[model samples]
Target: MPDLLETVIENRWMVQPNHANNLDTAHGGNVMKWMDEAGAMSAMHFTGETCVTAHMDEVNFKQPIPVGDIALVKSYVYRAGEHSVRVRTRVFRENPGKTETELTTESYMIFVAIDEDRNTTSVPELTVGSERGERLREEALSDAP
Candidate 1:
């Protein structure tokens, strides 16, 4: 079994003109789409089954991403239950000159595993096999908002 931290999934989307709002920054809707996709991947990795978004705790846009910037979206399963998986996601702006990545957005999402019949299904217990995985789970629990 892989650790939850090792199960992290990431996707990158270039900020295009169509994805931007009137201000020329990446639109909130587009960001949400990226977050949803990345978070779903993480949930699927943890559950080994298809999942649907049960709830979005909160999406905080800390900084604006420009049209030319690349949005690096990363997600990992932080906690899991019988049918629900909690995922933590972060969006970063890719900048070559910066030594540190700039966090643009973050959110906590909950997904419910589903069977082929469209009914909720049980998932395996989350194994925090590594120290990093345990740390992330603790952080997720501590930071409710």
Candidate 2:
């Protein structure tokens, strides 16, 4: 069993000029890419096998991450089926100097565990290791809108 909390991952990407759009903010594709990477990492952590995106819930872009901002991407495994793991991923626009942050994107991703032969494999069951883990799981599920 893999604890949900143990699969959590957080990553930050600086919005470089090349990654910006004509609006001088991070491109939507870039944000999605970051989210996918974070989500995939969480899935891999939970499954202990190569995980690939099987499906993704609709993404809602709430805000833009402007140039010079940090895209803070966080992901965690909330639940898992026999062969697929569901991960919640979110990106926030962060101003490190001022310590301000705002939600930019939220999405749920599903990844299927695969073996070297590209065959689907069974993933570890999601286990609740602590009270905090259970609370976080519930919070994420309820907060997802």
Candidate 3:
């Protein structure tokens, strides 16, 4: 079994001019790319197999992260089927000088485990190893619209 908490991942990236658009904010595509990478890591951690994205929910961009801000991406596996992992991923904007962060984007992503031959494989059964893990799973489930 794979512990859901153990598969949670958080990463930070500094937004630079290259990642911004004419409005001087992080491009939507770049933000999604970061989310995908983080989500894939969570899925791989839970499956212990090579995983590729199967689908992604429509992304809702609520805020813009300015070029000087830092993008904080967090991803975690909340549920799993026989061969697919469901991950909840969220991105936030963090100003370098402030501790608070604002939600910028959120979406759910599905990843399928695959072998070297690209055949789908079984994913480890998911288990909540701690109270926190269970709470996160509930949160993810309840937040779906």
Task: Please state every model's RMSD to the true fold in angstroms.
Answer: 1.5, 1.2, 0.7
Off by over 4 Å in 1: 96-99
Per residue, candidate 3 scores C-alpha lDDT tens digits across 41-70 of: 999999999999999999999999999999
TM-score of 3: 0.98
Off by over 4 Å in 2: 143-145
Candidate 2 residue lDDT tens string, 1-145 = 8898899899999999999999999999999999999999999998989999999899999999989989999999998899998899999889978787898899988999999999999998899889988987997789765
Best by TM-score: 3
- Choose 2 or 3, whichever is better by lDDT: 3
Q: Indicate whether candidate 1 or candidate 3 has the larger lDDT.
A: 3
TM-score of 1: 0.92
Q: Model 3 scores what on Cα lDDT?
A: 0.96
Candidate ranking under lDDT, highest first, comes to 3, 2, 1
TM-score of each: 0.92, 0.95, 0.98
Ranking by TM-score: 3, 2, 1
lDDT, candidate 1, equals: 0.88
- Report residue 58 deviation for candidate 3 (angstroms): 0.7
Worst 10 residues of 2 by lDDT: 136-145
